[model samples]
Target: MIIESKVIQGKKLIFNFRSAKKEDASNLSVLRLKIDEETEFLDREPGENFLSPLDFEKLIYEDSISEKNIFLVAEIDDKLVGFARLQGNNLSRFRHKAEFGICILKDYWGFGIGNSMLESILMVADSNGIEKVSLYVVETNTKAIELYEKYGFKREGLLEKDRIHKDGKYYNTVLMGRLANKLKSQ
Candidate 1:
């Protein structure tokens, strides 16, 4: 399930977006840790990622074959700078829905990479008959929230004290979702 696409960033950078490959496992492992360290917005803490390259390779292999899952990477000058994933349930009752998550290096922020990745993933979801896509975002991520909203995702609920950060404080998580049929209707 490879996605072939490209985006221009700030009139200078050219970003290549595609599905993650087994060969990317090593770089992704390192990049994931770096991204987690760069921000508390993600679910993991720095040095908390325990997955090895082999684990990532296995996961990518599984995701590649799963109709309800996709792993995407954004690369600039052949360097992995961002990534996004879509995870869907296998149960009969929840087959029409999926959850999406995205992360980009702090230095690469505001470059339209996230936007491109979301659009591409949504396109894949829609093509695969995924009726709804949902995600959880920390309440303080206004930029991400705004981006999601612009893509027709509505806040469905808030989970209080959902995440504890390095500041030793609890933060709420916003649950947001978008319905493919609804988007088409609107």
Candidate 2:
């Protein structure tokens, strides 16, 4: 796919929003861990058997051009601060849909980085022939929910008590989705 690069947030940041490169794997993995540490709503802890940076590098090299999977990273001042991924089955029957996920460092949460990253991902998905994109968000992540809603994603269902955190408390998971056609229609 042909991805584009642009700057956002009044030029305070620059977003390439392109396919993840092998060199980016290490930074991407680190950013993922940082995001996980900042948010307790995730299903797993940051140190719980997370994939190695080398493994992520290999995966990115292998699947970088795959139509059913897309990985993106947001860099500012040549540092990776956030990343997003979209994955789906390659089989013809399920090719129209994809699962999406995103993470950003805590310090970058309110700086329009997430919004720019997500918007770029949605555009990439739409251009790649994906009909719908789905994601699960913990109920406590109101800011993320608001961002998703602003981008036209709607709550499709709920998975109650879906995740048990280290605190021994269960949290509800909300499934949200948006159709490319629906977004275009709006």
Off by over 4 Å in 2: 10-17, 182-186
Residue 4, model 2: Cα distance from true site in angstroms: 3.6
lDDT of 1 at 152: 89
Candidate with top TM-score is 1
Worst 10 residues of 2 by lDDT: 1-10
lDDT of 2 by residue, 1-186 (tens): 325555565245544545678878777777777788888866669877586789888768655768767777777778888887778668788789998788778777787777877877787788888888999999999999999999989999999999988888889999999999655676
Across residues 1-186, which tens digit of lDDT does each residue of candidate 1 receive? 566566556434678888999999999899989898899898888888567899889989988998878999999989999999998888899999999999899988988888888998898888898999999999999999999999989999999999999899999999999999645687
Model 1, runs deviating above 4 Å: 5-12, 182-186
Candidate 1, number of clashes: 0
Worst 10 residues of 1 by lDDT: 4-13
